[model samples]
Target chain A: MFSLLLQSFVCCRFLSSLWLSQHSVVCLLLQVLLTHITISNSQHNTPNPTMMKSIVARAYSPFCSVFATEDCDKLANDLGYEDLITLLAPHGDSVGRATVRDSQGMTNTYDDFAIRLGAKRPTERDSGGMLFNPDAMEALLREYIGHYNSDDSAFARFFAKLVAAPPDTAFETFSQPAAHLFCVSSRNAHPLDTLQALAQGQKRDKDCLNFYVLVHDARVEDAENSTQRTIALLERAKKRFGLAGMIKLGQEGVPETIPTPQFLTVGDELVNLKTGVGFGSRTLSQPDKESIRSLLREFTVQHLIPHMERCIMTWDTVAAGKRGLTGRMFSAGKKWLKFGGSEKQEAGSSIQASGIYPQGSPEQTIRRLADYAFMLRDYRYAYATYELVKRDFLSDKAWKYLAACQEQAAVALLMYTTRLTEKQRVEVLNPLLDSACYTYISRLQLPQYALRMLVVTSDLQCLLGPDAASQGATQWFQKLLDERLVGRLGYALIMLRVSYAFSQSPKGRKAALWQLLSAREWADANQKGEMAKCLDMTAPVYDELNWPNNEGTLLTRLKGELANEAKPTSVAS
Target chain B: MSYYLAIVGTEDNPIYTQEFGTYRQGGDGNSRFSPEMKELAPFILHAAIDMVEQTASRTNQLYLRTVDNFYSHLVSAFVTAGDIKIMLLHETRNEESIRQFFQEVHDLYVKTLLSPFYFVNQPITSPVFDQRIKSLAKKYL
Candidate 1:
């Protein structure tokens, strides 16, 4: 049994060895197959599988079994089957066969296949989706619309782009949300050509451009024809585009010195726009008749007539002083006269003239008339008109005009006193003077007018001296200077006048000198640089004369005072 | 339609022309022109130009209808605010149908002036224009 067992053991060893070797071979083959499968899966499962497939397809022939046997199910899962289908739908023919197969015969639904191809969709493999970001859309729209520079074409482009865009996009992009695409061109091009181009462009594309053409300096065949043409154009534009679009036919720069009637006529034409004539300060300095007429016409046609009456009424007080009842009646009466009726007959007639005037109420008429009278050179009439209107318009334009007229009339009466007797002088002149002074010192509305009145008042007081008759005027002048209603120049003039008055008085020499010294100092302090230079040039002569004892010393002190006068560093607030 | 055409020069001078007709469905092109329309043609044209200029600068545009009437004659303007217009006013046999006639006249006007020789606001006294006007009246009236 031992020998037999030994022989069987030898046989068993050989069988076992054979079995072990075969098992090893089988395991090795199985290991190789599994490794191959794993390698294939890894290659297919790589990031950007599409790119890798494209590369593999490019490198190998069409019959490459390696691609043929690709586990498309796994690949589809890795690459996002839905995304691939969406991407290939528009460009299935362009995509590789393997990709097309992987996409399950899906087709792009978008009309723009190229656009679809360019588009990217979010996938497990992709970090970000191909969908447009809100921020990026905003940036793009901003860049596009922000290019507007108000040029006609640029404006059209901007408008076209804006309206063509989604409403939400447009609102988010523009600061002015309601800005239209209309444009005005100041160039020398035919407006018709521009309009045709714009119309054609807009027609070609339903959402292309909405355009309005403006012809700058468009020359009309003639004035009458041109105005008619302009009206026609406006009407057409209105009908076509409502008020949203317009073409302005702007006449270029007109001559500054046109005739008064012509200027007035132009002003009347432009009155509809209510654009006031722009006269700079320099223009105001040398205002010609045409300029004044233009100004007046604009004021009347645009502001005054539309709000006031067709006729301006003024009560001529100075004329009233001479002509009595007739002057006052004519001055104030004509204002109330109806356009087509006699003054007496139209006394109670309706103020409203159907087409003649709109706001021809008595108050408006009186106010306008007062303004007209105030601007007139004849102070007598102006004063009367103002007085007539004053009771109605207290402490306003009418009151101010009345005061001015009164003051001016007083000055005139004083200047021409040869015809007046002492009684008349005392009766008319004194009251007039008092009224003038009171108005200047108390109710002077405008600074320039106040300054003028103050100068005249001081001069009159100086001429009258320190008598009881001049006491009221003197006190008023002093008060006015102290109040500073008048500026530094007025103050100096007042001081000089006071000094002269005191010097003329008996036993007033010492007071006169004090006043004169004060005047000199004020004058010196306020002297303009050019005026100071002139004074410096004349100083030596005054000093050499020495009409007053130590006058040279005083004059020198005046010069010193002038030198001490600081150059004004700040303007009045 | 009694048409009053005026060319207002830049200097406010008015050059006026007029024609009267009612071009409508199965109606005779010739209509009795009112003497008032003829007499007031210049004034009507001038006023239309004035109204146009006045309204052109405004932010609104609407044809001012029957601005002035002189005893059975009315003045109306279709302003372009840059070119001349043919204003029309007449006692229409049928007021409602006048709009269609007016539109036809306007189209003919626009077409006739399409030639370069015909400048804006120029008097339309051409025989060709007259023929076209007559033809348009025949077609529409």
Candidate 2:
């Protein structure tokens, strides 16, 4: 019986070992299959149409994807690879195609899928999720680049948007060939890289690779490339990528270089390149001219206006002496003057006459008509003028003027809220806001404006409340504040004002507490007397609430007590 | 045709006034208002100011109709958004002629408005404005 049991045990051990081997093999095969499935699925799936549409809308073009070999085979079979090649080939060039093909072959693998599986995926990046979802990328590429002709301004704008940042991961997934092509052709190595580069440079470049290189050089003194090498690269980018505008090649040789006044001075050369005449005619038909102008207008109407308005509002509180119509008119007038051209003569003439040099000359007139229009309390004329100026400035590539115009446009839109339809609000306000945020975060020479814009954005977010959509904006502002682009004091004041306006019901007090705390902290800093005064004005409201005796409570009490003693009630009796 | 024009200030005070005639083809360059019309010129001009205000309020633009007529004389007004009105009363053949006449007057009004010496809704008493208006009438009429 013992011998029989030992034999049975040995048999059981042998069977168990064999079963373990089989199970291991199956698991390995399953892993392989899963990776292959993911690769194939990614290859088959395309980019999100909405994202692609946004890219297209921004770029103003249909963008083709560079498909991986397997995906290419599938797409080729379905859409004809030769036709696809022909479609994207011209943009690629023979050298570009060869380089792209070589790069694709070098990088091609199912390893990316395996790696993706290994890591926890980010739920979303910015407004969307999964930077590179192959199917979504493909679909997006098709939608973005499909119907539109290459030369369309829409295509240019879309391309500009894509090249403005890094090539997205969706861009990477959908078309390896196209991705490779963009990598070689544009300055940005990738989308995230582009965003990082843009963040560093404080400006967007439509030429991806070249912009990346230029900005890299601008930011990092110890970067591998020499100044001459950087300049050569920029020249190559200028020639090969058709890069427009002024590119700084020389070195002050510092990592994280603050842009010099010379950068703004470069506007003249850019303007000349755009208009072909130095401040001669108000319009230009050249594509680069138009693109630059549109960009400027977008920047100004969206970014600069809000800053100026905030500046005005801040001035209203701080510099109350300058709050008259003439001063307001003067500030707005300066913006219009920058754009060139006259509306009503007094509008322009008065500006000129004020001894405040218009954009071109000290003697030139800055019109008051635009100011009147902007301040008319009816926004139709203001909106129209803003649109016109935006279009004209964008076409002209008048960078300074464009920036100013976009800033003004934002303020006008915000102030004239009743005039905009829902669709118009979304269409106009979103771009304006985006542009403003972009400019401010980019840190282009309007620091005060940037600070003011952060306030506006914060206000808008508060107004919108805490929705999933707004959460992104809230995060954006948080990030902005975190970066110290906006000082705590400024951010707190704007937040206080926005919260006060948005808080309607009883919950408003709760909502206002955070702002009140921020305001109290700002008041404590107490550098600016006027800001302190404004804080003093708001303290009574917090005091009336009579909450816990924290720092917020103490500050409120002190301020409220002081205010009460300052004013005595007048009785008719 | 004789012309009587007045620029009224913000306070409805007369800032400037000019009287002239068509210095064009076969027309004498003389004021041709009837004695009574001439006597009533300021009142006529003042009345036109009321019409301008009413028209501007309604339309948000400042083109008033022929507000007053005195013995074949027609007074037409063009007011700017700033409440500055250019009132032109002319003795002309018909509506079409008067319309052409006013069109010229409008151009002169814009040119005058462009002048730094003039403020919106203020009396335009500048000699240069008067000379320009006289020249515009001669050239267009």
- Cα lDDT, model 2, residue A256: 26
Of the true interface contacts, what fraction does each candidate have?
A: 0.00, 0.00
Off by over 4 Å in 1: A1-228, A231-371, A374-378, A385-426, A436-479, A493-519, A522-544, A547-552, A560-573, B1-141
Q: After superposition, how far is residue A224 of candidate 1 from its true place, in Å?
A: 14
lDDT string for model 1 (A1-573, tens) is: 234445555655576667657566556545655664444223211122122222211211110000101122222223232221221222211222111110122322211111011111112221111112223323332332233222222212211221121111110111111111333233323444444444443324221123243322233356566556645664676566543222222234432322111111122213312332212111111222232233223322233222211222122222233246774565456455546745333333222332111223443344334433222122243344444544333322333334444554554443323244546556765665556556545653333344445445434433332452234344555656655653343344345444434333332322333243444544555444423533433332232333222323344445555555543433322
For residue A150, model 2's alpha carbon misses the true position, in angstroms, by 59
What is the C-alpha DockQ of each candidate?
Answer: 0.00, 0.01
Per-candidate Cα lDDT values, in order, are 0.36, 0.39
How do the residues A209-285 of candidate 2 rate in per-residue lDDT, one tens digit apiece? 22121322133455456445545655655564443222222223322211111111122223433443322222212
Categorize the docking of model 2: incorrect
